[model samples]
Target: MADQTRRVHFVLSTHWDREWYMTFQQFRYRLVKLMDRILEGWNTGELQGPMQTDGQAVLLEDYLEVRPERRAEIEQRAREGKLVIGPWYAMPDEFLVSGESLVRNLRLGREVARQFGGTPSCAGFTCDIFGHNSQLPQIYAGFDQAAALIWRGVNTWDKRTLPWEGADGTVMPAFRFGLSGYCTYAHKVRGRPGSPESSDPDWVRRQIDDQLAWDAECTDTDAILFFDGCDHNEWDPLSYRILAERFEEESGGFEVVHTDLDAFVKEMAAQADRIQTRVVGELREPAEHSLMRDNQWLIPGVMSSRVWIKQDNAACEKLLTRHAEPLGALSNYLLNREYPSGLLNVAWRWLLKNHPHDSICGCSIDQVHEDMKFRFSQCRGIGEVITSDTLLRLAANVGEPVEADSTRVLLWNGALTPVDGSVEVTLQIPADWPTFNEFFGFELKPGFRIYDAEGN
Candidate 1:
């Protein structure tokens, strides 16, 4: 109250889910069209952008997949810091995936962002995730990420910003924009920027003043945030341009800035001493703010909506982690065989594509789930092939013992400890056994034959 009218940082962002109601390619094509214009604005200096594009590196891969021609332009935008992306391969459901998978997701995101002369946004932008895990502070801090921008799963009492403490005692700034989510400001504005109602300077001033005053009560810091875009929103250069100009002209004592998550976090952190800090870890927050709930309607019924999809997803995860990756690594280490890293990366990406909160939560449309099934099939197929091939290569080197009409197949347990369990062996006319089929005093079925371990 003693100082100036707080600085309002307008963060423009689009929460682009790679696939939710539609297929990945379908959504990606629209993203390409959106980026084309957003980048064009950057190149022409028409839009002063710090527009955040959903913090997922996978979108860049998606955009480049269809429009390889615009690689240079896109790279330039990234270099210029006009387009902020990554810190995640895909915005994942924290509860669904393994902790290791989350680490890999962030690692790949940082790597991808580095390729285009831009670092991943320093803020962990978990804007739309249903909730967050406690380990996130440690994970984000591992990558040197300084803060988190959260929308969902925020406690109204926390007042949007909290000092998120990890299991390891690592602390990071966490900003929460709740109630109406990240695009609350955009919703408050009447129609498009050029509309008669939206163009009024006095009206715009009142809205800003009211929002700032309301937000001011929520925190001790003089910095307030206004997110300018919504879900799957296209980058409207004209609207942003008009608003940017209007805010500058009639900010009503507040310093208006078009910023990204990183800059905003830094600004907030700079005045960290003045702002209240609540040490937090797991941020499921109150049930009231849960995206899984909307008033009396419990929306997270989708968690159990499609049991079969979840079952298949579990199977695929086990196949990749327990079998495929281990076998591939062993084969590369022991046999000097080329590890199928590319195949594994493709498989992991396919898996991550379905890890979006809506997609993996089974809350999407039938068509989207159908596409997810296809992606799951592709990932599982590749993983199976890698595991089977590695097993075959390793098995080939084992010595076989001969016993009369039967052949002994030696089993090599890949694990370090001695295995004392029953093993299923497929007999295919053992090395020394001359006969194709033999029964162990049991009747042979029409299509099945039983062979004794000992030749008879």
Candidate 2:
């Protein structure tokens, strides 16, 4: 066991989720509001501070509220290497979007991480997924991630161990979550002053204790503890006070500390060899049905930070994975010359501001059309061809691979610019393999299948 006296890992994690589809004015307004809120807590000594005097603060911003103007500040932090702007995917319901849509979100999340002061070479999945599918390891591995920060269904890979391999046979990032690591939480009351939920101290403490306790059977393993950000206590003075006291009282031993996913994942990676692995499924408490339209977002699915974030940090894991291949290639292709990979960053924000389909609130069909056209136009100067991987990503997200979509393969000047020919894709489809063939045009092989859209 980790030494009890000096083993407490005090973590301070705060959520920054933004919805960007609104007018820039609204976008900026929300930005200011979020910043103010964060500042208020930090200034007031409310946030869980670093251990010594005031606890160190780690801000985990979910790209739910993204804008170009704010990008500079975020990028500055990343460049400075002080803070880690983890991953760029919109939160929640990964399945609701097309596969390409999912990857696009992943791409943007990492692009911003590079711009910001954080190194998301690894990813985080803040979500507590209904099923932490086996195939994720391959998808994530394709992006070159070492580990992930998450808490989902009881499913584990490699016969119950860390870094489970997916259907594509890729190893996943190290996974962690919670008060100890599986799922994190400070307080989330409902229907009360703090949460619209009760701020009962007894109720909250019990929840925290449950997460912090250790399991003996969890020997020689790689697992994650996710703190549930039920968020009902966002502004609850009482809960904050109790939380602060808990940290002070239990400063020694492996005490409870609220923390960001990045900080923890870094700890695991530095000692990756020691970590073990396993594969197990939830025969215990089952995951809730995906109650919301897409993951858990305010506007149903496209990209609103509100409900979407509680879905967990899965976006970060996926994003870091998605960018690894292209970034490595682009770095080599750079030959010390700047090849404008940053263009992908601009294109990323454009898409986040205008994801396909409509928001969960049900806008007019005309509103959807207007949003798409405006977004497509914004993406025009983004220079998609800079990376074959990027263009192919566009094709996959375009859906159905029609012949005319600009993203589709086209012929001009006696040369053929391939659409799906950009990047190869592979995943572990189900026994219901035909569902994939009907949609994505592929068959699930027995184990670890791969599809090279842009193959040799």
Candidate 3:
């Protein structure tokens, strides 16, 4: 009863964490070697690539920072469809950052992809995020994403593919990762000297058969996806050859092809009408059938673990969106001041770098989080300076200059609607004023009083 004509799509990818157990520079060192192997494999005919860079374009940025001379080669591979990237600048945890941050992440990622002469993949690839938000389907739909490939925080009910519906009722096709997740065929395809696949010639065949059997049980689609890489994995020079040879010579009535997420998404879209299950609003079930002994539960503790990081993240986000950006744009519109788009972009990029799951989740090593603190400070500093400059400029544009001895306070609301509440303002007293004693609490000379613009 097995489907003999099924086609297996082998997606070779490495989930590159910009920083995790090691620091960013250390990880980038490994990434440089990985990229070298991948590019060399493709150039020397060792790998028939269409390798996915974990659905993030920042990895390319990281690789290029160290290997600037290889830009042309990398672009050539991307142009030739040997490299797949984007749809996210970095794979960030959904709940940790502001929703606007996620949008900018996608926009920046797509822009980076285009800069590299490659079209970003439209698949919502949530490969290793701790969990997903409810509005993700709508967000993906807004970006015209075709489908989603998910691994964690989902209960597929034994079905490999289903329709995921967002809170607002937007729906998209979603493909769930199987028991072994993205590394199902990783070890088998790139066997080490004493690994099971190398010790026994028949081991690879049996593994493939078992994988295909599991795929059969999960979904009835003719296209089966086999992810052939894992965390920080290097390019396997022989992966394509090994898979191609097995499917070619064994003649097990199956076909294997080296492909990427885009093609796989297209395959899923083709079978959309037949997909029966429809999941609604946020997948955070932590399905009990996961390959991990811990059942792949969502690590909820990360939300409050090292809470200061989250507080700083929120503070930066508010400063950027609620104050800095809005004021900058208003000043640009009304005062004819040039908008600081480039500077804002830089600020956002610094903040978004901290949004990655491991980095923002505070689950990484001390060095990683330490690096994050610096980025947060940089972002905060930019937002604060911009807000301060814009406020001063706007105040100067609207109000006349005050006397040297007089004090003038400016209160401008950045909100769209009228807000009436008790407001606190800091007053800079003249240096000549008497300082208050800690014990006696003496009153300062020339007591200040508040006044409206009409002199009330």
Task: Please name the candidate that would achieve the greatest lDDT relative to the true structure.
Answer: 3
Residues 213-309, candidate 1, lDDT per residue (tens digit)? 6666776566777777677776655446555774654355577778787887887877766657575677765456444322112244656778787
**Best by the TM-score measure:** 3
Ranking the candidates on TM-score from highest down gives: 3, 1, 2
Clashing pairs in 3: none
Candidate 3 contains a number of clashing pairs equal to: 0
Error of 2 at 179 (Å): 12
Native-referenced Cα lDDT, model 1? 0.73
* Cα error of candidate 3 at position 14, Å: 0.2
Model 3 lDDT tens row, 1-456: 344566677788898888989999999989999988888777787676588889899999888988999999889878877878789998889998889999999999888888898888887888887778998888888888899887678766467788888999988898877655665556544556446555454665566677667776677566778887688987654445556675433256667777888888888788788788778887887557634422356787888888999999999998999899999999999999999998999998999899999999999999899899899999999999999999888877665576575566778776668878998877777776444445666744445566666556
Against the true structure, what is each candidate's TM-score?
0.84, 0.51, 0.92
TM-score, structure 3 vs. true: 0.92
Clashing pairs in 1: 160-176
Scored against the true structure, residue 117 in model 2 reaches a CA lDDT of 50
Give the worst 10-residue stretch by lDDT in candidate 1: 289-298
Candidate 2 Cα errors over 4 Å, as ranges:
1-31, 44-83, 89-108, 126-144, 151-162, 173-207, 214-237, 248-253, 268-277, 280-345, 352-373, 380-410, 413-456
What TM-score does candidate 2 get on C-alpha atoms?
0.51
